[model samples]
Target: MYSFKSRIRYSEVNERKTLDLSSVINYFQDCSTFHSEDTGNGIDYLTSQNRVWLLNSWQIIVYRYPVLFETIKVSTNPYSFKSMFGYRNFMIQDENDAVCVVADSKWIYLNSDTLRPVRVAESDIASYGLGEKIPMDYKQGNIILPEQRVSKEPFPVVPANIDTNHHVNNGQYIKMAENYLPDQFSIRQMRAEYRSAATLGDVIYPEVALTDTSCTVCLASENKKPYAIIEFIS
Candidate 1:
């Protein structure tokens, strides 16, 4: 596993001074990116070869939210790869070595020139040992939204929402959904599936369905086709 230590910065905390869901997801993303770079298959190298990795889905479970300024360790490893898909797991532990967050993610290798999926070369990632899954009961699954639900005003895709890929970053989708959640609930787990890319000037219509213990948010286009689905369990 690739590991790195960091402190929860003030900017990463919520109003309650606790680490926010987007920050947790950022930690996982950074750790995996570092691992890829360390293994000689990082963004710079891949892009030079006309390739890039795109996140397909994520399932994150949070047991505890570290407070601002708390020290934590983030780690990740590629556990499996087949065809164009790669499966990885991530973990965040407090200073006491207690695991606070666990997540599993799926990513796809893409040919930048054609913007299409391509097979991941086994030798490119074989160094990170495979076949071991994270010890968590949470599984990645489809998130279904009811036909009728609360629809919020469409959010314009601003300049800040665009990332290096020229599309709305994955974490931004989670943050947009979080805004629609009731203030009474505290997020304990989140599962998001990326169905399409939303770029600059594209407005997203967010719709939500809430339950006693969980909530589902779908960010879609004007025609109602979804770009991302986020399920939050309180």
Candidate 2:
């Protein structure tokens, strides 16, 4: 496991002065990226080899949101690698050593040039050996969507949404989905399934479904094919 200590920044918190769910997701994302870089298999190497690891899905549970300026520790562990798929677990712990947030993620290793799944190399596994899986009620497969939903206005993907991969950043999707959430909805758990990449100039038509306990948002193309599906459970 790779671990790092940090203090909650004012920019990372919500109006309540507590860390928001989207920022929590960003921490995990950054931790994993740091893990890759420290392991000598980072973006530069991936790009050199014409390879990229695309996020497949995410399952994050927030036990409590840390307040601004609170000291915390963020960590990530790569627990499994099967063929083209890689699994990882991430956590954020308070100064007291209590876990405040935990996440499970799936990734697909692909040939960047072809954008097709490929087997992970032996060198890749050797650098980042698998660790024990984190304890959680692991939910596999796609987040189930409700049959009925309402469509929102379509928006164009701007450069700000693009990352080094030249596509929408994984966390940005969650940020987008959060806008459709009901006010004051305290999210305890969130899950997302990434179906395809959305690049600059692409328009996203958001479809939202809501219930007393949950909200589901599908960010899709004009044809109604989903780019990603995000679910939040309060």
Candidate 3:
């Protein structure tokens, strides 16, 4: 496992002065990226080889969100790799070593040019040797759509939503889904499934479904095909 220690920054917090859900995802994403960089399989190498890793799904469970200025440790480890897919775990711990958040994620290795799944090389797998899977009731990547949903006004994908791959960042989709959440709804867990990439100029028509215990948001194209589906459990 690879880890990093840092204090929760003001910019990372929400109006409640605590680290927000999107920042937590960013930390986990960065931790894995840092691990790859240190292992000599970073951006430069991946770009040179025309290879990239696209997040397929995320399952994050938060025990509590850390407040601004709080010191915390973020860690991540790849637990398994199969063909074009990789499985990983992430955790955020407080200064006292109590875990505040844990997440399991699935990613697909891809050919950058083709944007299609590709088998990860043996060398790449060796670089990040498998670690023990963390404790979490892992869910499948597929998210079940609610029977009833309401459509929101369509919005264009903005520049801030795009990542290095020129598609909407995985965390951005979660942030987008949060826009439709109930006021003061506290999320204990979040799951997102990326169905397709949404790039600049693409219009997103959001469809939201709510229940007593959860909210589901499907960020879809104008034609109703999903770019991503996110579920927030309160």
Candidate 1 structure quality by residue, lDDT tens digits, 67-182: 99999999897888999999999999998899999999999889988989999886767766775787998673577776767988998999998888888999999989999888
lDDT of 2 at 189: 95
Candidate 3's displacement at residue 231, Å, is: 0.2
**How many clashing residue pairs, candidate 1?**
0
Clash counts per candidate, in order, are 0, 0, 0
1 or 3: which has the higher lDDT? 3
lDDT of 3 at 36: 93
- Summing lDDT over every window of 10 consecutive residues in candidate 3, give the lowest-scoring window: 133-142
Task: Quote each prediction's TM-score.
Answer: 0.96, 0.98, 0.98
Q: After superposition, how far is residue 189 of candidate 1 from its true place, in Å?
A: 0.7
Candidate 3 has an lDDT of 0.93
lDDT of 2 by residue, 19-78 (tens): 998899888888988989999999999999999999999999989999999999999999
TM-score of 1: 0.96
Cα misplacement distance, residue 36 of candidate 1 (Å): 1.2
User: Model 1 scores what on Cα lDDT?
Assistant: 0.90
Query: Which residue pairs in candidate 3 collide?
Result: none
